[model samples]
Target: MNTNRPIRRALVSVYDKDGIEVLAEAFKRQGTEVVSTGSTARRLGELGVKVTEVEKVTGFPESLGGRVKTLDPHIHAGILADMTNPDQAKELKRLGIKPFDMVVVNLYPFADTVRSGAGESDVIEKIDIGGPSMIRAAAKNSASVAVITDPEDYQLAAQRVDSGEGFTLDERRCLAAKAFARTASYDATITEWTSKHWAKPGTINVPPVNADESNDATNAAKTTAPADNPQFPPTFTRTWERAHTLRYGENPHQQACLYADGLDRDGFAHAEQLNGKPMSYNNYVDADAAWRAVWDFAPQIAVAVCKHNNPCGLAIGETVAEAHLKAHACDPMSAYGGVIAANSTVTLEMAQNVRPIFTEVIVAPDYEPEALELLKTKKKNLRILRVANRPHTRTQFRQIDGGVLVQSIDRIDAEGDDSANWQLVSGDPADRATLKDLAFAWRAIRCVKSNAILLAHDQATVGIGMGQVNRVDSCHLAVERANTLADGENRAKGSVAASDAFFPFADGAEALIDAGVKAIVQPGGSIRDQEVIDAAQTHGTTMYLTHTRHFFH
Candidate 1:
């Protein structure tokens, strides 16, 4: 690679004008001429930089409503010529095309255009055929050219070009990878739009093309089997960027990376490291996992304390600061180094109460200026981020072996009326505390996997036993653990119970009654609802029936 040859001429086209003037001046200082088209040339001229208009090279006016300006071989040949190939070198010289030593181009705002509610006709017209074409050409001839994409990368590119290195081989390779990723993301967006909106459902699913598990099959070159079938099939094309690097995996030796979707407009993807240090791998995974569990509630203040991806303590409070104090108090020993996410703005008082703890991460929608300043001073490396609520239209996504799994927002847990649809044969109308406990239990049950049991006290979950095989056993686990986790409060004693699904027999409710639970809440749709209600009434417990069943798995 000729790293020392000065850039004689460069093709420049971009949607973003940021830092372009500084770059143009640097290129001119290095004796490299800047050639651009349309708004780019005009913007450069306005900034007092010497820029050659596209008409000078293409010998054509900026015509057809500015659409046919830069799509010329005179421009592309300058970008795409191979200095290594004798034929390519000779043709470029014979055609009077100066090989473009650099290409500074960024595509049109295709992603943002769609996001702004533009129609397909309007959005499709904004796709830049020339910008990406120029980028690919420069990237393909990286042996003698430089490609710059992000405005953030302009400084590095300027530094390299001034230092007379013309971008090291490694930097060139990295730019090529980024360029391909940009184009691929554009293509994927188009594919998803075509498949979901333009074509009917089930149009893309076909039988497996190859019974292979290699990386090539993972790519979308061939259509595979139908989703949900037993045969391994690569489905949706995942587009995610690294969220952060963790200290380690669940075990120390394992490696992990946190990734956000390509089109993440807000929330965790845009979480800013305000004052403190970088986040660890576990901190990110646990913090986000806890945030997901808590964002289901309303905009009110809720505190979720997570230890190793499980909730050691969770509480909803009157204020963000109060929630922090109460949630931390749930099990201070367990909350020592856990990740805490609040469903509201974190205040200074909350930060003061939590800053002293040896926790790894603290995340919220926004933080008070004083709160961040104080916390940053105390904990020089605590990862504090501002992403208090779920982004608009949040979707839960996961990867399973050969394919991806996506589901609804997971917050839609309640769906029907208890008084009209549920059958109850037991005690009288439940009291206020009983209803609140039922709501708490409902919320807790949705967090648990199917066949789960949740017990609560004072509108706070005391014990949650999830993913059990038998209903009775799950009930027993929740009941037993509540006594220990609840710190002898005895919520089960004269307290309420809520089940995610209806009890098939009287035994499930009986298990709680034996533990001194005085009330019950459930969907109450089972054929044995009479028996369950009889057991509840006989046990002197008021049972409220919410018709909605939250069977999460």
Candidate 2:
């Protein structure tokens, strides 16, 4: 690769002209001719820079209302012609086509226009076709051309031309990579928008192809699948932009960064930090856990305290202050240096109650003025975030070793009013008073890791045991935590229990019953579900089958 190639002729066409004049001045100083399109040329000429219009260079006027401006042999050949090949150079000279050594371009703002409530047809018109074409042509011929897509890169281009030298091969290749990514992201945004608007539900009228009639069974199978089971019309594509770099990853030694699909996204990704030092990686993890746990009970004054991505305490109350106090009493030891989230605005009384605790972060939909001032006075370094209370995405995603795993979010109605799948296959159905706490425990347990158990009394968490190796162990841990809180007087007595999954055997049910759990809620899918129900009956305890598993891991 040639390390240094002088940029003698430059073409500058862009929708954003923030730094175009400075670039034009640098090109003029280097004796490089500047060629541009309609508005770009007019703007540059007005800035007192000499410019050549695209019509003069290409010998064709801009047509189709500016859509067919740069898609010409003259423009593409100038960008793609091989300067090193003698035969190619001779052909270019015979045709009187001058080679372009540099291209500076920025595409139309399709994403911004779509976001700004523009009409569909208006947004569609803003998608730039010729700009990406020129960018790709210049990038493909990076050996002889330099491509610049961002205004931030103007300084790099100016510095090289001003140094009496040209761009190195490495610099050109780097810029080419960026140009390709820009085009790809732009196309993906357009695809997403079109799919959302045009792709609708309809049955495929075509009959399924018969596999037995074809000699090649594999081909027949592929052909019949789409007709038999139609899916969404467009292919799925993901796009993300970098948010910022984190201080570190899960540990201080590892590096990490955050990225989001959009900047206006709510929740932890776009939370407003009102008062605090910068949040760490662990703070983000815990804060997200706490936030989602609280959102499960939104429109209610609910509170969730989390540690290590597991909820340590959860409670629902009529007032924010009462919820904070009750949630803190669930497991005071585990709540140390934990993250807390509230469903409604944090009141001043709630802030004062939790201010004495050594909490890492506090998050809510909003905060009262007095509450915000009190919290800032209490701890200068505590992270306080206010989310905009938006609806969460329907899908959840996680990264694996080689690929990603995505699934529909567990938006089960824990209260059982919206679901017809719930069953009461046990000694007896939970009464109205107990069912409220059962629903509370069910929602809270879903945010914990697998093999999870939670015991609640009067809509407040008494104990939570999560991430155990076995269901029986989780039951024991929950019982132990409750007993410790009650000073060995059996606080689990008459409390409702919820599990993330079904019990494999009757021992877990018997254990919970012996520990004074009066009622239970589980998914009820194991083969020994009858035995577990028998155990519950034998211990004189009631049980309800939700028929829905809410496993987090």
Candidate 3:
């Protein structure tokens, strides 16, 4: 079969007209016949390029508010015809239908329209019918027809035309793959939006049970099956556009690429990189973890230094610089080469403090001009990103062996901050200052991995121990780091500790108390809760039960 096919006759229709003039110029230079639809015909005409309209080729004017133009057999036959086949070529001649050697088309901005909060009717109208049909038809016959779906590829298509070589078989196949991906993502977006808007509670029909058979089994099955389209639908489809290929994944040996959800949302995916090299997989993972950690202490200037997707140091202060200083003090050894995130703007003072440190990435809502300049000049390898303050997605997804686990994000609610709701289970009640430190530790602990233990003083973590198999080991690790890493004093002395979950045994609470933790907070639902409470009382450590576990696995 012939692989090289020249773009002698082409069909062009697009909603985004960026770089279309290049293709038009190529068509004119190559003396190629162009058939365009609706505004595209006018656009090419305005560019001083002569073009035949779709109505002239199809002998049918566009109807249904410009939705029925390209759906005709005339357009699809021209696109899909295998001209190399002698019989197909003769049929095209018999019908007086000119085959299209190339199809340049881009679909309507349905995703963008839906994201813009447009009305239902307006969004429905934005879903392209003929556009996908033409794209798919041309792509299916990629050996004979070249399909262009992105404006970025228009220049390449034009260059191929100008070179008079058209597209190679390899190039055509690549373009076809991209075209199919575009249509697939478009359909996925439409499916997601429509499901949310149109889905209703549906009932399942059950066969009548025999009089001797048990009705209890049937009743249980009915209750287990979803009666309505809840958060988890029967079918789930999500689409992500490839942002760029990363240098590597978590390891240098693995290949990886970044994908974005194609939404105008505030997140690390949409963050603006102000300076430094491209981010790595580990950098992004740790940066996002750090960002979420700091933001959990919202309305206050907070900072978090994360390593291996775990918060190593976290703190709140009057200023971002102060917060960084205190947070860095929490485990300076671990903060080295870590990703840092600030809830407030990064100041010059903070940049100066961070300059000496070999940090991987630093992300904040914004950065002072001078701070950004300093980092750009000094830290050439450090990734500096500016994100916006907004609520993150409520749902979180984690992949398991065969399927994904979906759950609501463990957001630190107002109750976490309110010590009033906490029960003073053991020892005396904490004072306002001690209660404030307890609250900070509680909020910060949510970012730690279970079994997690955090020791904090003056709104700053003194030590963090996480991802241990046993809670007792985590408590000991936290205290050991706090005392051994302190500059001149025992950092755990008079400090408060927070556990992500209840202590299954008294040994965990005893370890924290023995390390000089003055106060402790935990969910407190273990069967041995009384034993842990008694241990805390014996050490005169004030322990509060939140009755809410924040186990991050």
Tens-digit per-residue lDDT, 447-538, candidate 1:
55668777666655666666778888888877777776546766557656778788998898999999988777788789988898888888
TM-score of each: 0.72, 0.91, 0.86
Reference-based lDDT, residue 408, model 3: 68
Per-residue lDDT of model 2, residues 1-553, tens digit only: 4478887788999999998877777877877788999999998888776899998888899999898899889999999987777888889999999998899999998877876778988898998999999999999988889999989999888877777667888888999999999898888778767766775455535554564665676675455445333122224465767777899999999998877654135646878899888888889989988888888877778999999999889999999899988898888888999999998889999999988999999999899999999999978888999998644765567899986765557775645523244677776666788878887888788798889999999788998888999999999999899889655657788888998899999988888899889899888889999999888877778888877788877
Q: Report the number of clashing residue pairs per model.
A: 8, 0, 0
Task: Return the number of clashes found in candidate 2.
Answer: 0
Worst 10 residues of 2 by lDDT: 225-234
For candidate 3, give the lDDT. Answer: 0.88
Colliding pairs, model 1:
243-258, 245-281, 246-280, 246-281, 247-281, 364-388, 365-388, 418-547
Whole-model lDDT, candidate 2? 0.84
Model 2: which residue pairs collide? Answer: none
What TM-score should be assigned to candidate 3?
0.86
lDDT of each: 0.72, 0.84, 0.88
Q: After superposition, how far is residue 180 of candidate 3 from its true place, in Å?
A: 1.3
- Tens-place lDDT per residue, model 3, 1-553, is 5578888888999999988999988988888889999999999999877899999888888998887998888898999888778999899889888899899999899978876878999999999999999999999988789999999998999998898878878888899999999999999888777766885644554455456756887756545544353455666687877887999998999999988766445567878888888998988899999989998888999999999999889999999999999999988998889999998999999999999999999999999999999998999999999997554766678999999976667898747446679999888889989999999999999999999999999999998889999999999999998988777579888999999999999999888898889999999999999999999888788999998889998
Error of 3 at 417 (Å): 7.2
Backbone clashes in candidate 3 total 0
- True lDDT of residue 319, candidate 2: 97
